[model samples]
Target: MNDYKATVAVIGLGGIGGVAAASLCHGGCHEVVACGRRPLDRLRLERPEGEVEVPIRTLTDPQDASPVDWVLLVTKAQDTASAAPWLERLCGPATRVAVMQNGIDHAARVKPFIGEAIVVPTIVYYNGERIAPDHVRIRHIGDNDMLAPDTEDGRAFAALFENVPISVGLSADFTTLAWRKLMINVVVNPITALTRLRQGVLQHTDIRNLTRQILDEAVAVARADGADLKDDEAERMAQFIGGFPEDAGSSMYFDTLAGRPLESRALTGALVEIGSRHGIPTPVNTSLLALTNAVSDANG
Candidate 1:
């Protein structure tokens, strides 16, 4: 059996990171060392039902964070470089780092700092937001479903959340899972940001069709990258998009609307790059990427 008393160090106490920290802490699995650039005591969390005050040791610098058995990197994909200093300090010989972020390049993004450390890529399905430095609102906790490569460490990681409210498991085909999530994000995120509408707004025939176009391009890219996805994955993605709350807004939408730096490159930009590699025409994704970049630049 895996030990439940391991220490977990969480870097980047933003929405996803904070919620995961809180959940892990509340589950009593590990002693959480919440590290960020700011004070942890001042960090607050907002839940859909109400606000919960998270009790965690806040470290302003990575050097101050205690080395632990595991480290969960929750920063945006674009912030990988900025988080390098923290990874350098928190990762130890046996530390297994779980990356809970978007994109399919989780391992490639953090390999520079953690080097041979066991890196597990996780697909986070929660909807959360940081309304303030200390306050985060979780719109949907959803299922704690995470897709990681099947290995000894992967099984151990899955065991940590077993019997808890979260569902963690190994994916024999992680590439397909990651690519599937990427395609879903490509279709839903940029469109919501551009239209300034929630997910449900895409129910309109025109919006739904446009979403399909985006998914079609992304699916081509995924197939080119050797992911085993069905040809009908794009249609399923559109159907999934329609199931979210009518007023549900994506993280990218919220970030762009709040004037925060959007993770455009990680989302749409990566799609275009991958599509180019496969010689697949990704005009729809390319257009969305261009539009998102334009909006980001204009806002800046």
Candidate 2:
């Protein structure tokens, strides 16, 4: 069984990271520390029913941090390299690092930074939007806020959020689930970012057609990579996109609007890279990645 009063350290304070810190603080069960470049006194989370406010114990320097039971690496996929300093100081043999970022192969991504610490890869379903440095809004996207592989560490990760609003589900077929989420991500994020529009943009006829090609190519790559995706996964993805709130925007969308570098390399780029290895043609994603990378480079 996992300890209820575990010491949890949260690295990165973006939208996703901010919600995580606030939720853990709201639980009041764990000793939670927020690690980032800047110090935050408190966090206010806008929930569906009400607002949750929690004081944050933030560490602005890696030298001030100690080993913790859990570390939620909530930085963007491109920012993982920058979090290495904190990982070095906060990780011990017994530490479990939960990676809550885009893309797959989470273990492999963090292996170089963490020596022997266990990696808990997760599929985040909650839509967390940072309104300000210390304020965020959480929109429950689906039944579960996150999904992890059904294992000891996964269960312990779930237990950590037991009293929080975020719900973590476990599944034996995590690979398939990750691919399923990837399909939706590749479509919504890129299309929205490129157009500077919201989820409502998915309703356009042109966007629908473009997303179809993107999903078709991504699913092919997923199948080649050993994911047990269904024949109609693209159609299912379209259905899900049709249900998204029109006013809602994706992380990439907001990033583009804010002139921040896009995470295209992680979302669209990952699929294209795998497609090359499998000898599968991902023309659609390649084109999208190229365009998005151009935008990301302009911002960088």
Clashes of each: 6, 0
TM-score of 2: 0.96
Per-residue lDDT over 73-172 for candidate 2, one digit per residue giving the tens place of the 0 to 100 score: 9999988989999999999999999999989768888989988899999999998888989999998978999999999999999999988879999999
- In terms of lDDT, model 2 sits at 0.91
lDDT (Cα, tens digit) per residue for candidate 1, span 1-300:
456677788888788887777667666767777878877664465655565565777777776765578888998887888988888888877789998899988887788998557788888776657766767655554454566678877787777675445567687888898888887788778888888888877898999889888888888889999899787988888788777678778877887888877778888888898788778988888888999888877765
Residue 170 lDDT in model 2?
Answer: 99
TM for candidate 1 is 0.89
Measured by lDDT, the strongest candidate is: 2
Best by TM-score: 2
Tell me how candidate 1 scores on lDDT. 0.78
